[model samples]
Target: MNEYDIKDTIAALATAYSKSALAVIRMSGSKALQIASKICFYANNENKNIENFEHRKSYYALIKDENNIPIDELIVLSTLAPNTFTSEDTIEFISHGSIIVIDSLMKLIIKNGARSANKGEFTYRAYINGRIGISEAEAIHDLIDSSNKLMAEASIYKMRGRLTREIDKLRENIKNSLMIVYGELDFPEDDTESFSYNKLIEIFIQIKNDIENILSNSKRVESLINGIKVAILGKVNAGKSSIFNMILENERAIVSNIAGTTRDFLSESIYIENIPFYFMDTAGFHKKADNDIELEGIERAKKCAYESDIILAVFDNSCNANDDDINLIEFLNTLNNKNIIYIINKNDEDKKFNYKIESGNIISISTKTKEGRETLMQALKNHTSDSDIYIFNKESYVNNREKSFLEMGLKQIDICIEKSISSFSLDEIAEEMNILNNIIGNVSGKIDAEEVINEIFANFCIGK
Candidate 1:
C-alpha cells in the first residue's frame, strides 16, 4: 500500500542527541524497509535478503557511501506492515552516533523517498497504532525530558491510563445519578423504584470523597510539578541566609556580618536527591525605621514565607531563642498544613537551646562549617513531604484551574449527599449533582475549553 501523497517512509534520528557513540535513525511508514533496503550495504552473509528474515527482527547491513561502498556498519531492524510501532512497517538503523554519519544517512534515506519525521511523530504513531491512549501519549511527552525522577514517575503513571480510568468512572457515576432522576420522572406509578434514593446518596458520597481525596493532594502535586518552594526565614544574623546558600551548594546569597545585609528575597532552584526545590533567602522579619528603605524588603519576605510551600524557621543558635523567634514560630503554626521546619543554626558552637517549640522535625545546623546539613535536608524532606515518593509517580497533578472546578463540584456533591440522606427529593439532588457535569465538562473539554486544552497539550510534544 502507498503512504501519503508521493508515498514512502517517515524517518527520524532517535538517539536524542546529534553526537553520541551511535545514533539510531528510526523510520516508520508503508515502505520503510523498501526505502532503506535500496541503499543499505549488507556486510554479513545473512544480509543477502532484507525480507524473509523476520517480521520484527534485525539484520546485519552496511550503509554505503555515495560511491556504493560500505562507510558504516549498521544493524537494520524492521517490523513488517500492520504489526509494527506505526502499524505500517518500521525500520530502525543503528548507525555511528557521529553527527556527520547520522546526517549523511538521514539525507540518503530522504533522497531515497523517506521524509524526516517531525518532533514526537514516532510516539504519535505509537498512539495512532493503538499502542497507547491519549493520556499515555501525553505522559510519553513528559517522560522524554523530565527534569526530576518524581516528575517522570508521575508522567509514567498517567501514561499508564490511570487518569482516563478515573475520569471514566466519575463520569459514569454521574450518569447513573442522572438516570435515577429521570427514572423517577419516567415512571411515577410503577409502585416501586428502579434506583433507591438511599443507594444513590451513598454512591454519590463515595464519589464526593474520591474527589475530595484528589483535591486534598492537589496543592502538593503543584509543589512537585514546580518544585517545592522553601523559604529560609528568621531575624537578621540568624544565619538563615547562610543556610540557604548551604542547601544550594553555591554562593547563591551574599553572607555578611551586617545584620540586615539581605533585604530582598533571593532564590535558587536546587535538586534534593530526586526532588527539586526553589529555596528562598528572605530578609529579616523585624521592625525597621519608618524611613528605612529596608522595611520594604522585610515586607516582601513576610509575603514570601506566607506563600511558601515550606518554611525553614531558623533561630540564632549563638543566642537563646528570643521573642522574635517565638512569635514567628506561632505565626508559622497558623498556616495549618504548611511545612515549617525549625532549625537552630550555629549549634556547632555552644549556645542556649530552647526546646519549648512544638515544631515537628526540629534540628540544629552550622552553615558556616556545613555541619548536620544532610540531616537538615532529610529533616526538611520529612517535614514537607506527605509522601516518600516526592516525584509522586502515582499522582496526576490536577492543575490549579481544574482543582477549583473540582472543588466546586465536590462542594455541590457534598450538599447533594446531605439533602439525599435527609429525604429531600433526589430529583432536586440529581439536579445539583448534574451541575457538576458542566464543571467537569469544562475540565475535560466536553465543552469548548480549547484555550485551556491547548495551553496544557502544547506543553506536550507535537506528536503527543
Candidate 2:
C-alpha cells in the first residue's frame, strides 16, 4: 500500500463480476502488449494480431489456452504509452460476463506476464504518471461512490479541475507577493520598491480573506457531499413511522397502531429536488419507560436528536395533548439552532389536540391520504436556500485532508499578517510564505506524495 510498482504489469477485472452482458479485464505496464500478443489471435485466422497492434483501436481476437484451443472470443483494445490512463502500454479484454471466462483470462494474463492488481493500483499508477492531481483523484473516488445527484455534480466539478484552478490561482498570488518581498530583501538600495509594514499587511489581508471564505463555506460543501441528517421524534404512537414511510413513498419502516412497536431508529436516503436528505425515524419519546428495553430506546432517541441537523417533531391529532406530548415540546425547546418542523399527523381525523410550539415550521399531513406531501417537500427545499447551498464562489471543494491543509495555510497566513504589523523583516515574511507554499503543495499532493496518494487511492476499487 505504501508504494506501487508500475514496472510489473498489473491486471484485474474492471467491470463488475456479476452476471452481465460484458466484462472488461484491464492490464497496464510495459509487458501488457507482449502478454496480449502471445495469447490473442485473429478471429478468422491463427495469426497473432500483436504485429498489427495499434494504439487506441479495438480488434476482435480469439484468446487461446496453452493447448492452442480457443477459450473465448473477445475484443481487445490497446492504448500505448504517454497518452493512456496509467501512462503505459495498456490492454483491455472485453469478453462475456462469465465468472469462468474472467477467471481463466486473468489466470492466463498472470501466467503470461501480468500480476493481479491490488486495490487502486491502476489509479495509483495514473497518479504517479501525472495523469491527475490529488484532488482530481479523490474526486474520481467521490464520483464513483456518490449516492445522489448533488454529490455527483460536486464530484464532477472537482474532477474537472475547478478546485485545482482556484488553488493554483491562490498559489500564484502568494508567489507574486513573495517575489516582491524577496526583491526588496536582495536589493534594498536598488530601484526596487521597499514595502512598509502597513502595505504588506494590506496584501496579506486579501490572501487571508480568500482562505477564510473557503473555511467558512466548508459546511455547505459537506452538505452537498454528505447530505443532512434529519431525525423524527415524538411521543409513542405519534405516527412517526407513518410519516417516515410517507416521505420515502415506500414501506421502508413498519407502521403499527400499538405503542412502543419500534425500539430502534431507521434511516433512509431520499432526494428532494436534487438535494440528498437522510431521514431517521427514532423510537417515540415518553416520560417514563415501561421496561429496560423502552428505556434504552428513549436514550437512543435522545442521541439521534443530538446528532441531527434537523428534527421533525411529530404530533398526533386524533386525541388531546398528554403529559408526554408536553414533555416532548419542552425537550424540543432546548435545542437551539436546529431546524425543527412540527408535523401534525392524522390531519384527516377529528382534531382534538390544540398544541402550541415555539418552532415556526409547522405542517399538517395525513399518512393514509398522503396529504401535504408537496407542501412539506417545498418547506424542506426552502430551508436550503441558494446562499445556504453554495456559500462560496465555487460549486465544489477538497476533502477533509485538503481542508485541513487549507486551514493550516490559513494559520500560517494569519501569523504572517500579525507579524507584518510589527517590526518584522522581509526575510521573516518570506520564510512564512515558504511555509504557506509547502502547505498548499501538500494540499495538491506536491509534498508528501506517498501519504496523500496512499490515502486517496487506498479506498478505490481494484482496476480503477
Candidate 3:
C-alpha cells in the first residue's frame, strides 16, 4: 500500500512502550472497530465480543488472542466514523504498560487485521479527510515537540486555526484585488465602477507591509520555538568558561587559568526565566595562534560570534586590555549587527586594566564574588525579547515552510507594484495577479496541499 493510503487498518502504541500504569494502542481506519471487536471481549465473559460496543465510550474488556484466551484487561475506547481523529472509525486499547504485553497486543491486532502505522500516517489521514489543514497537522507536531510553554502556546494557536484564518483573510484580499484587475481588463467599455490604479497599488502595498511585519517579527517566534543562541566571547584567559559555568549552574566547561584552554566550542541549552537559551562557550580569541589547532579554534570562535543572536564579550577588569581583546572588539563590529554586551569579569580583582570600552550594554561582573549576574540576565532577557511572551498572542508565527512561500509572494507583489507604477498593460498586471494568486495559495497550502501534507507529516512520529 502507498504511504498516504488510509484504506487499511493501522495500529501503533501511542504511549511510550515502557513499564508504566497504562499504554494506549491507537488504531484508525474503516475496519478499526472491526479489528478491535475480534480481539476485545467483555471482562466478565470471555466468549462475549464487543459487537454492540457504544461509540465515543470506553468499555472495560479483556484483550484476547485467536484461541479466545485472555491476555490483559484493558479499557477499549471506540469513536465512530465522521467524528474521529482521522474522520474514520477509530479504536484505542488502553492496556497495561509492559513491553511483552504491548508486543502481544500489537501482534493480536495485526493478526485480526490492523497494520503498523507509518510515521504521521494518522495525522496524514486527518489532513486528507479534511479534518485538519496542513498547518494544523504541522501544529500537532510542534505541540508534541515543543520545548517550553511559549512554544506549545504558539502551536496551540495555530492548531486552533489562527494561522489558517489569517492566511485565508490575506488570500481573500488578494483575490478581491485580482477580481478588480480582471474587471478592468475584461470590461474596458463598461462604465461600472472599479478600483482605480492608485487604489490597487495601495492595497498591494498594505498586503506587502503586513507580510513584512510577520517576517521581521519571525525571529522572536523562532527563538521561542527553537531556543535562542547566546555565545560567550573574550580573549584567552578572560574567565569566559567561569561565566559560562555560572550561567549554566554547572561545571559543563573546563575552567582553568591556562590561556587558550577551550579549543572548541561547547554549547548547552538552559532555561532563563521560562525562556530557552542555548548558551555557547566559544573558544577564546587569540591574536596569534601557536598551532594549527589553535588557529581552527579561533576560526570557530569567529563563526560563533557571527551566528549568535546575543554575544557576551568578556573583558578582564584586573589586567590591561591586550591585542587579542582589541581584536575581539573590532571583530564584533564586523558581525551582522548582533546584540553585544561588554562584560567586565573579575570585578573582585583590583582594577588594573585601563578599561576604555564605551557602551550602555556593558556590565561588570565577578564570577568569584557572583556580582552583576542579575544585570547580565536582564540584558539577555532584553536582547532576546523574553519580556514579550505574548508576541504570538495575536499574529501566527511563520514556520520555515511558510516563510519561504511568504518571501516568494512578497517578491512577486513588489514586482507587480513596480509594473503598476510604470503604467504597464492591464493584461500584464492581470497575469502578475494570477501568479500572485497561485503564490498565495502556496502560502496557505490551497494549491499544493498534498505536497505540503507529505512534507509536514513525514517529520512526525508514528501514531500521532
Candidate 4:
C-alpha cells in the first residue's frame, strides 16, 4: 500500500460530541475487519474467512461484550480494500447516538490497537492515497463544515471534483504548452520542431487569457470562501458608527453625535443575505492637526480603504459633503476599479446646498431611522461569490503561508507569460509553469510524499 494507507487499523467516533439519534464509529486499516468481527456475532463471521468488505455487506448482528453479553443490536458496513475512503480496508459501526456510547466504542478500538484520528486527517489521507486530490480534500472538509446552504452547495460541487476539473484542465493546458516549449528548447534551430513565431505568440496569448480567467474566477472563489471585507469609511461623526450599528441590528459600535466619539477602528463579522462579511467601522478621516489617538484611527481607516475588499464611503447627506469627504471620495475615484458603495447618511436633515454629489452614486439612508441600511447590506451580499465554495466565500485562506504560495505562483506565471510573449523563450516559460505546478501541489504538503496518512486523517473528525 502507498504511504496514504495507515499501517495499523485506525478508528474514531465519527459523530459530533453532542447527543443525536445515531453515532457511527468508523475504522480503517489492515486489521479493521478483524476488529469488527470480534464484536459482531453473525453467520460464521468469527470462524469463516470473509471476502472483501463489500462482498460481506451489512449484517444484522448483536454487538456483544467480550463475554457475549449483548451491548446493542446494530447494522455494520464493511467496505473492502481499494473500494473504501482511504482505498484501504474500512468498516463502520452504526450504533447508538450518545457521545458516551461513541466514546466507549472508540476507546475499545484503541484498546484493540486501532488509534484514533485527528482533525482534517481523513480528507488528508484521501488526498495522500490518490482517492482524491488536494482540492477534493479541501472541499470535503468544507462540505462537512459548511455553515450555510450556499457554502454547502459549493463544497459539494468541489467535492464532486468541480474545482479539480477546472484546475486539471488548466494544468492540462500548461502541460501541453510545456511539451511545445520543451520541444522548441530542444530544437531551437529546427523550423519544424519549433513553433512559428506567430504560433508561439498565439499559444502564449491563449495561456495568458486562460490564466487571467483563473484569476478572475478566483475572485468568485475567494468571495465564496471568505466573504468580502468591507471597510466602512468616512470622517468621524459622519454617522459611520451609526450606519454600522444599524446594519448589525445590535449596537456593535458606540454611536454618539459627538465628534471624535470613535477614536479607533472596530470590526465585526456579519452575515448579510447569507453572505459572510467582515465589516470594519472606521474612524472619521482628516485633520492631521487633531488628537493623536483620533489621528491614528484616521490613518488606519485610510489603510483599510486601500486594502479592503470593498470600500463603503460615507458622506453626510444631512450636511454638505465636506471637503474632507470630497477629498476621500476623489481619492477613491482614482480606484474606480474597486468595489465601492457610497452611503449618504443622516437623510432627515436639510439637503445640503454646498456638497453636491451624484445621488445615483450612493445609497441614501438615515441611520437614526434605520433607513436604507438594508440596501447597504444587500450591496455587500451582491458581491459575495462562491470561492472554493467549501473552504471560503472569498480568499478565506486560514494562514499567510497558503496566501504566499498562491501569490508566488501567480507572480511567477504572470512574469513568465509576459516574457514568453516577447522573447518566446520556451525554456523560461516551461520553467515557470513547472514551478507553478509545484507551488500548487505543495499547498497541501503533498510534494514530499512521506507525511504519514494519519497526520492528514487526523485533521478530520472521526466520523468522516
Candidate 5:
C-alpha cells in the first residue's frame, strides 16, 4: 500500500536525457517482462513473446503506443529474477539518445503499467533485495559523483566489497571475544577455563587498534574526495594573481600594477596528477590599508590562508623587503600546521627583495615569462604525495557516516577494556560488546533502518 512498494514495476531513463548516440532506460519488478511485452514488439513487427525471450539476451524491438503507433527502435535486454542488479525481473532498453524518443518510450512504458522510478530507486531495490550492501550502495554513489581518477578508484575498491570484508572481519573478531565472555558468564562451572582479564584487555586493545588504523586516513580520504585547498598569500603587487592565473591556465584573476586589485578571494578547482586541488587567490597582505575595503580584503586573505591546506607565500623580487613583506613572513611563521611554499616572483627583474624563510621549499620564478610553472606544479604534487594522500594500497577509507560509527565502536571497546580490567561483572562487558556489534552492523548493513536507507539513497541520482 506504500508509494514505494517493491512489488510494483518501476521504469526510468538511466542515462542523461540529451541528444547523444544512445541512452539506456531501466525497468525492474516482478512484472517488468510482462510490461515490456505490452509496449515492445520484435523488429519484424511480431508481438514480443516474453515466454520465448532468453534471460540476459538482447532483442531488437520496436516500442509502440496502445494505438499501435511506433515510438522508437531500441534493443531490449531481458534479465530474469535473482540474477540482475535489482534481483528482480528486469528489462533494459538501449535506445537512440533523443529527448523526444526517450520521453515517448518512457510514457508508453508507464502507460502500460510501470510507474516512474524515484531517484536511486534501482540501487535502492538492489539494496532491499540483498544484492548489494549499504556500503556498496554508497560506493556506487561516490563512483558516480567522483571528480578525479583517484576518487573513482577508491570508490570502485569499496564498491567491490573490500570495505565490507574488512568490517565483517572486525565484527567476527568482536563476536568471538563476546562469545568467550558469554560462555564464562553462562557456564562458570564448565571445565573450560574462564577468559582471563588480561587476555580480554589485550583482545579489546587489538580491536581498538584495528579501528584506529581504519580511521587513520579518513580525513585525508575526505580531502581527496572533496579537494585540497591551496591559498595564495603575499603582499600587494607581489604577483599573487599572476601565479593564480598561471596555475588555472586562465586569466581568472585580474592582474594589475596597482595595489589591492584583488579586493576579495577567488577560488577555482583543477586536477593535478589525478588529484583535485582548489586554488584560492586572496587579496595581498599589507600593514597599512588605503581604505576599509582594502582592510577587509586583507583580513579575509588572512582567514583564507589559515583555512587552506597549503599556502603559497609570494615575495616581490623587484622591490626591497618592507614592513608589508616582513608582516607577511611573520604571519606565515605563525601557521605551524600549514605547508608553506615560498615563491619569489618577478625573477626577470633585478633581485632586490632578498629576505627568505629560514626553512621551506622556495622557488624563484617570473610569472611574466611563465618560467618555473612545471616546478611549481611538481611541488604541489609533491605536497599531496605525502603518506596520507597517496595511499592507494589502503583496503578502504571510511566516509563521515562510517567514521562516526567506527568512533562509537572504538569508544565502546575502550569501555569494555576498562570494565574487563576492573569490574567483575562479565555481563556488563558482554552488554557493551553487544552494543559494539550493533554499531558494526549499522556500518555493514546487517542491521537495517528505514531512515538510514532513505538518507543514503537520497544522495544518488535518479535511475541509479
Candidate 6:
C-alpha cells in the first residue's frame, strides 16, 4: 500500500504555523473523531464525552497529552462523514497560533492514532471521493496563490464549477452530434431523420468556434494571473524616469536634466486598481551614444520595448521634434500588436512639441505638477479591463493544460469535418469524434488517467 493510503486517519496544520492570534489543525478519516476524542475534553464540563459533541457546532475544549496533562485551550468543530470536504468523518481544532502549541497538538494527535498527511493529501482525498472535479481542484490552488483581484475572481468562478459546466455542455453537444452520425451509418434506409452533411459540418463548426473562442482568452488569463509588463521608451531627457516615478508614486528612478543620466533600466511592480502592472523605466533613446555603456543601455531599452505588452512612448514637450524623436516614432511604428500610449511629458513647461501622431491613446502630463496621472491610470485600467477573463460569461476559461487539450480537440474536429466533406466512410469520422470526446473528457477529469490526476493534485499545497 502507498504511504498516503486514504484509509489512514490523517492530521495536519491547516493554517500557517507562524505565531499569530489563532491557527487551525484539521483531521479526516474514519477514526478522526475517535482520535480527536482521546486528546480533547469539553471545557464547560470535564465529564462530557467527546463522542457526544454536536456536529457542526463549536465547543470550547481542553486538549491533553498522552499522560492526560493539559496542553492548551481550543475550540473544536466536529463533522460526520459524507458532508465534509473529504467526505469523511472530520474534526477541526482552532487553537492558539503558537508553533509550540501546534507542534504539541499534532504530535498528540498522531500518538492517539492519526498520521501526518502528505502534501495536498486532503484535497486529493476530496477529488478521489468525487466531491469536486479536476478544474475545481486546480482552482483551489490558484485561489490560494492569487496575487491580484482579477485572478482571485477568475479562480472563484472556476472553483464554483463555472468552467466545468461549460465543458459539460460542450461535451453534450458533441455526443449528440456523434449520435446522429451513428444513426445515419447504422440505418441508411430509415427515413425518419435524414443526416445532412451540411448540418453536421455546421454543428462541428459551431463547436470548433466555441473552443477557439475560449482558447483565445487563455493568454489574457495568464496576463491577469501573472502581470502585464509595460516598458517606458523615449528620447534623452524626455522625462521617462520622471514619469516612472510619478506612476509608482515614489522616487524609485533618478530624475535629472542631463542626457544619458540613466544608463540602465529599472523595474518595479505596483498594483493599480487591484491589477498588477510591472513598469520598466528604460534608458532614453539617442541617435549617437556618448559611450559604449550608453549604447548598450539604448539597445536594452529597445529590447525591453520589443518584449513588453505595452509601451509608453514619452516625448519632450519643451523641445521641437529632432532626429532622435522622429527615429523613436518610426521605431514604435515598426512594432506590431503592441499597446502604445504616446505620452507628452514636461507639460508644465512652455509648449513647443508639434509632432503630429494619429492615435487616440495619447495623454499630456507634467511629472512635476502630477497632472494627467489619473488619466494615465484610467488608461491602464481600460486596457486591462478589456480582457474577458475577468467576466463569467458562460464561457470556459482554460489553464495551460486544458488549453492544450482543447487545441487537440479542435484538431480532431477539423479532421472530422475534412472526412465528412470528402464523402469518406462515416466510421472514420465517428472515430475522430470519439477522439475529440475523450480529449474533452480529459479537460474535465471525467476520464483522466491516474497519473494525470496525481500530477494535478501534486501541485497543491499541503493541508489544502
Question: Which residue pairs come into collision in candidate 5?
Answer: none
Model 5 lDDT per residue over 13-52, tens place = 9999889999999999987888887777888855654445
- What lDDT is reached at residue 254 by model 4? 89
Q: What are the per-residue Cα lDDT tens digits for candidate 3 across 1-464?
A: 27767788899999986899999999999888778888888899878888865779999998888876678998999899899889999999898998889999999989888899998999888877889887788888989998788789889988888878877877888888888888877786793465578888998998899778777666667766677788899988999999999988788999988878899999998887777888889887888888999889989988887778889999998899889889888888777768888999999999876858776488989998889999898888876543446675666777888888889989999998999898898889988977877886666556455665666777989789
Candidate 4 Cα misplacement greater than 4 A, ranges = 1-5, 18-21, 42-57, 145-148, 178-198, 269-272, 320-327, 330-336, 358-360, 369-446, 449-464
RMSD of each: 5.1, 2.8, 2.2, 5.0, 2.4, 2.6
- Locate the minimum summed-lDDT window of 10 residues in model 6: 387-396
Among all candidates shown, the one with the greatest lDDT: 5
- lDDT, candidate 1, 1-464, per-residue tens: 02222244678777665578887888887767677767775577424534443687877887775566565787888778677656678788888788888878888888888887665566656654667654565567777867877777776777676665666678788887787677776786673555677887778887887787676665566577678888888987898878987888888788999878887899888777656888889988774434466778777877888778788988887877766676677667677667777888897788886647764768878887898898987876764545735435455766455567778878878777778778787567767777876666544334354354345444544322
- How should the candidates be ordered by lDDT, best one leading? 5, 6, 2, 3, 1, 4
Q: Relative to the true structure, how large is the alpha-carbon lDDT of every model?
A: 0.72, 0.84, 0.84, 0.68, 0.86, 0.85
List candidate 1 stretches off by more than 4 Å.
1-9, 45-49, 64-71, 80-86, 178-191, 194-198, 221-227, 245-253, 268-278, 289-293, 317-334, 347-378, 384-395, 399-464
Model 6, span 13-95: residue lDDT tens: 98987999999999999989788777788787665556665568788898878676787899999888898999998899999
For model 3 the local lDDT of residue 412 reads: 92
Which pairs clash inside model 6? none
Clashes of 2: 0
Off by over 4 Å in 6: 1-3, 221-228, 288-296, 384-396, 447-449
- Tell me the TM-score of each prediction against the true structure: 0.76, 0.90, 0.93, 0.77, 0.92, 0.91
Per-residue lDDT over 1-464 for candidate 2, one digit per residue giving the tens place of the 0 to 100 score: 43577778999999998888899999999998889989999898866555556889998899998878777898999999989988989999999998889989999999998899988888778878898777888888889998777778888888877777778878988898898888788777884455567777887888888777766676677765587788999999999999899889999998888888889999998888777788899998989889899989988998989888888899999999998899888898788888888899899999978877654799999999989888887877776878876553365676888889998998999999887888687788899988998897777657565565666677999889
- Candidate 3, after superposition: displacement of residue 374 in Å? 1.9
Candidate 4 lDDT, 14-80, residue by residue in tens: 7677789887878877888888766667644543423334544887666655555556666788888
- Report the Cα lDDT for candidate 5: 0.86
The true-structure Cα RMSD of candidate 5 reads 2.4
Of 1 and 3, the candidate ranking higher by lDDT:
3
